[model samples]
Target: MGDVSITVLDGDTLRSLHVSLREDTVSLTGAQVLDLAESEASRSLLGLSLPQHLKSSALRRMNIDGVDDDVDFRRKELSPEEASRKLNEYLSAIADELKDNPLVASNLDGSALRMLLEDEDDFAMIAENLFTDLDTEDKGMISKREIRNAVVNMGVEMGVPPLEEFPLINDILKKHGAEEEGELGQSQFAELLQPILQEVADALAKNHFAVIHNIKIVNGSELKKVLANEKKLNDVIAKIKQEKDNGKSGHKSTEIIKDFLEKNGKELGLPPSEANEAVILLYDAVFADIDSGKGASEEEDEFRKLVTEILEKFAEQLEANPIYCDLDG
Candidate 1:
């Protein structure tokens, strides 16, 4: 029920309303937003996410299967709390859309979705070329030139449209000592674009472009900073639990989460490979339904409002999850 417009009612009048959707199916228990997945209109919102969005989501859940869940189901299913078990099938289907596009999934970032939304055909062609490298005789490794070709071709997938702004691309190449006119020929180039792509994806995912003044690659030691703030989040959540009316909106509360991994996001049990996953996870938990620019500006302003219901659900998960039962021992 990603970004669904849910209308709750009792009889002839509206009782409450809900609207939450995603570019991909969100992890059921990742945060506290199970209610967002339970709307009457949720299924109607599933078709909008791009295939890349769908694929990465599946891979992520698959990767987190045993560890993320309380019990190991080994790619089968897990014993999540009531919140976690709500919509497993729907989430799995979205993830299945990407099963064949693993390498492409590796290259996914918010930037790609931004490009896709700017122009669909360009994105389609770039995807076509990007995946071509996966099937090549060279053991499924795509060349930087191929990546460049895919990106630039994103300017015109059908070979018919005018190119939009690609300043981000030029900046990416320049940072690598690569020439503006130079073709990206090294795998390092793909590595180089990761942050920019992730930033773009984040912007697209959240619909608010947090300018990438400069890309700070997440290394092996950034998690310390991200988690340092976790205490702040835990404390706030604790306070909220005590009061049950901390009055913080879910989106704002998530902003305060202070990922302990931010500093050493790649180091403290974090993988640079999945550094961007944090942002995606955060946004997925909060908001990832609007792939295009639709209601983005407004969403930003009302991000907390949008997350109100999910936040409440998280509070419930915290109290009801069996992990707590085990911890209580």
Candidate 2:
């Protein structure tokens, strides 16, 4: 694909928008075209609050099977008919990705934070609350350095980037004389903090940052894959059976299976057993509803059936109510 200018319809407004890929070179490679497409998509959808992973997933889902990245498009330029077909296929693939992943977006233009700042009563209440939280010693004043903590507490929801992400926060603190070793009363703290927050708000308004939440969606997709693979399913069952045999003899088969799942559920499309109260409740509810009287003394076929039944229950439950867990956790 050479430096081509194409017009694509805006999905939201149904308006035709021009997307031009202009490069210094006469022609682009397969990889270059893909890259341009991704860049254009991101630029056009900048206002959409999409997580980074979803954007990358959309690109990966694009159809580019036979288009070799190393091939020179200038020498093997596609005919107009072929190019049109490929373009339509790529567009369809992109649309499919968006359709599969429902979009829930929130525009972070610092307008909310600005409104709070403009409200004297709200701003004073917020400042007072922050002071009370930071002043753990019940002192009348807090160190100037505590402003950093205040900003951190404001966080992404309040239009403040993490200190580690935007090092400009440190510069803002320094400029506001927050680094100096001095204690400020609640009123003074608010006065000094106002300018710092104002600067942050201004910076965000000029150049917004996209926040990638550390959350993963689990919807039994991986469980379905494991169930589909005979080898993997056999391996899991064998492992569980071995563990059951090795475990204390008096334990119910359900308990043994629950233990195995708690320890090794990630591969089967389940979240960490102790990730949060909701996951813990999910585990409790599932196990509680199943037969707890099943013991190791059951026949081998019966044991396999029990395991399959348990997994199917999990799959059904997850499909209905997908669990969201911290990706890092």
Candidate 3:
């Protein structure tokens, strides 16, 4: 939502600073400046909120000039101007490190999950959904171990982190005998799930988790760039023509174009064809409106027009309904 703020220990008291290299005035020591930079960089680049361990880990990896190790930086002092300059350098390095390995991160304070637990009807619906999803055999029962899967399925959107990221979840499962081999009816499952969820909520209330998502957002800006550049547009047209010539005989020009776009759309600011149902529908709708009877006999200029029109249509559609795609997948 909003830019995250960092809390720094200012002498005897802790003070919150909305650290911005462009706007904020720096009054902290070199150590405190590093702390602020690490926290701000983690939040900005990684989408982490209150990332206690992640901040420390990121700081260790950062190569700040004149700072060798933890103890050396801890004792170093800096004037306000020097602090700001160093903070910028440290954040720039962090940006470089994370440029290729982009992540979508969110802060989970457990409020939403706790609220769901508090509401009887909502919790009942959630438990029912989980039970149905877990009971793949349609037996109306699932193993207690599946509870772990249920929590994971709830995921960051529901304020539950992946078990691997938050080891405490495994401990909670063990404490509740959820790790034991046993099947549970829906009611029994809910009965056990409530306490485990309560404990998770309590733990999260104390210390939140910074959930990172391996997702990339496509919103048509890159398509706009491609459309604006004559050279890139010509290159795309040339590629499409090549694809048309090499494609299977008897396939319509529109079909060849659609296939090429689906395979190579990411660079053009389009989501993958299989990104989701919405993207599939978008491709279907765009292609359906075209003249499927148009063949390779069309002139190069006409084909270019068709390709440009198709790309424009896709750009317009994406601008209206931006898609989120799994970068890892």
Candidate 4:
């Protein structure tokens, strides 16, 4: 097996995966990967027994020498069945080695997880395990709803998650999943997560958005596209900022940009659902500023406030709303 980072685009689709092993990285997507999140199958063909967490395409990373395939994986395509078989061989081998470690299975219950979640590292490990473990049928991606469901079930099974929290998490994840009509692919996901992650990141920054003038508005795939090998997106954002006068006086002007994105994003052949998601992404990112208590920077505050007001248009329309970002912030 090789070291790999699998990105679950949106909530259900497997957007991209880059594997790293011995300094060699091979990224794959679509049908290129096989058994990305397998539960159980063949085993006995791996060096490191992959725990359940590692089974997820998002977490499987191993060192395989003489396997530098980054360019090839992206430019080349593989037969679905062939890719599946080769990938399965690796997964089975890893699973067999870790068979005894049920803790390595989907229902991750181990002494280490219990102790670790309690520590200050903040159980960031839990987030890892949450996203990586339990692939259902070993597909490259796991549904956001499934992950939360696993937690609620496991919490009850292990006595960790409160009964009250179980329903709440279930409701939230379910609501999010339902809002998306079940699954989210890369673009849809970028619409939701970029803002949420940026907001979360901002919260970690001195507790608010005002503390930082320049913040990452997008993350995951959207970030990859706009910022990859270029800084065009930053130019777009900066151009908008320069024209603004800082507070309510200049706030109305941003609406034009928003109108442009909303209209051009639609007229130029992008999906309206995706545009809706983009709007929400802005909301979530600004929610970080709102929640920070310090508010946005002098120049950015009004723009953010306009964004805050725009969030109201989304209302209970879950797919268009920031979902967790609204309440969380």
Candidate 5:
């Protein structure tokens, strides 16, 4: 209605909210207020905070027509693959929306742009504030100067260094075919940025699958911590896979791995007591993958002996009473 005001009186505090609408004035209790807030019209006009009972009542009212039934049923029926595809489609739409704004397109570059493309929440936040420093007068478009200023503002907000120059923005424009004298429009900027964003999405998707596969192959979660960089994840996975063909396994290798694990175990997602044991288990799996039914190599045998010795040293911490091969059963 014309204006809706919600006033809540607690023991000593009074909270009030005012919203304007074309409907008539109405006085409603807190529950009624919540019910009214559920309607699309009410939400479009203003936000209201209501208690649980009223919120439930309002939700029931909104669904009284059964318009949401089919959508809810479909959501419940969606498979994991279907849900993932739908989410990707939604993310792609949001990424595309970013391209339609020249100031947003120009302001993003370097690590900031990479993160924006990869993180939907971060991208939305930046896009929401796109017009804060730029003027949209040239046929609803931003100029080169505005783009430069926007980039500097974005960089500063992101805590990036050296705001005195706009080299990153200039470089982005040039790469997107913006000439020194030519004009840059939102559409053109978005079109050029689309491919880069797509590449980022693709890389992220590939890395995600690769990480899952590698973790499964190793049958371990210890790698998750040290594999912070996708490139490093790829490298480590490759090395583990090629261990049979090119891997060096021996007392020296065991010593080196043991030292690495002991020093960086916490950072690698392994506890101090089990760090050496995790490396031993991982190497065993890797060696098994490479052996192809063959026996362990002489070097591998030596490494295994060292690992056994190391594990025996930590036997008290492991709490395992099983006898070693050298001990009588």
Candidate 6:
């Protein structure tokens, strides 16, 4: 069998992967391709094994090269502000399109508008995912029927209907699906109509990341206080500083502290739910204090500096073993 060669071009980052079913060549199963797609280095290769037409369509949406289509995907990574700008343009276009729909006209106020205006990065991410999901035909365009179907699907996912009467709501859904000459092209709907934020937020509330944030917020604060007061914890931090000051090599201070706390956090009054929170807070506090010089006693300045160094090493380990770290600062 001929090998499948997938080339991913993300700006200057180019990667090519080849797989074959032939015994003479290196081969990967479908399951392996799916697994590899979840990794960041290979993530852009996700659509490569799809049907040729579908792969072309997906790459066009991402603006990747090699497509015969006119779409360009050579853009640089967006800054948060640039992402916000792109999302806002989409929101404005969608609001214009649905201006005549009573549901959109009357309901596009308050938090819905705030998400579009303020949380643009998050809104844009949701919009991108939604656009991909709604474009069922893989043509990159969303038909009027697709838009209506998306709304209905979101309503079902969110467990709420626009109207109390089920049949009436179905009628409205069908009516909306039949509008404006029956279809909206890729550029028209995919780019313009996907940034509607209220719907995005409602649908995303059940997402795992949001749930993790809520869990961390509730538990991380208590962990911070407990760790701040733990005497043994401070002792290890002080030792880390002393060794660095003496130019001594080979110290595993962060690991010592993390392992100690992982085993003894409950004895220090932290609840079981806050064990991982304690580990995260310890690293966060070290970096935060070092950066801000906050609350460092004259005698403890060296301690803070050493703690910063120790935490820097600890952060590398944390990235490698990020078991419970799901919240953002």
Top candidate, metric TM-score: 2
Estimate the lDDT of model 2: 0.67
Residue 251, model 2: Cα distance from true site in angstroms:
1.8
Indicate the residue-level lDDT of 11 in model 5: 10
TM-score of predicted model 1?
Answer: 0.19
Question: What's the candidate order when arranged by decreasing TM-score?
Answer: 2, 3, 6, 5, 4, 1
Q: Give the backbone clash total of model 6.
A: 1
Give the range where candidate 5 is weakest over 10 consecutive residues by summed lDDT.
208-217
**Candidate 5 residue-wise lDDT, 140-226, digit = tens:** 455544444544555433423233332344555455444444444555444444443344334333332110000111212333323
Steric clashes per prediction: 33, 0, 0, 15, 2, 1
> Per-residue lDDT tens digits of candidate 1, residues 151-248?
45433222211114334555454564434443333344444444544454553354322211112322212233323456643543454333323443
For model 4, residues 251-277, the per-residue Cα lDDT tens digits are 445454454455443222222424435
What Cα-based lDDT does every candidate model obtain?
0.35, 0.67, 0.72, 0.36, 0.35, 0.38
lDDT of 6 by residue, 25-114 (tens): 344332233233223222232212222333333333334337333222223333444433333332232222222110100111123333
- Name the TM-score of candidate 3: 0.60
Best lDDT among the predictions, by candidate number: 3
For every candidate, C-alpha RMSD to the true structure in Å: 20.4, 8.3, 8.7, 20.8, 21.9, 21.6
**In model 3, which residue pairs have backbone atoms overlapping below 3 Å?**
none
Candidate 2 or 6, higher TM-score?
2
Residue 36, model 1: lDDT of: 38
lDDT of 2 by residue, 1-329 (tens): 00111122223321233344433345544444544555545555544444445545544565223335224432355544444444444444555554333333233455656777888887888889999999999997999999999989877656676789778778889999988999999999999988888887777677666554455666676787788888999999999889877854577788888899999998777878878888887887787777756655467888898888788878778778777676556
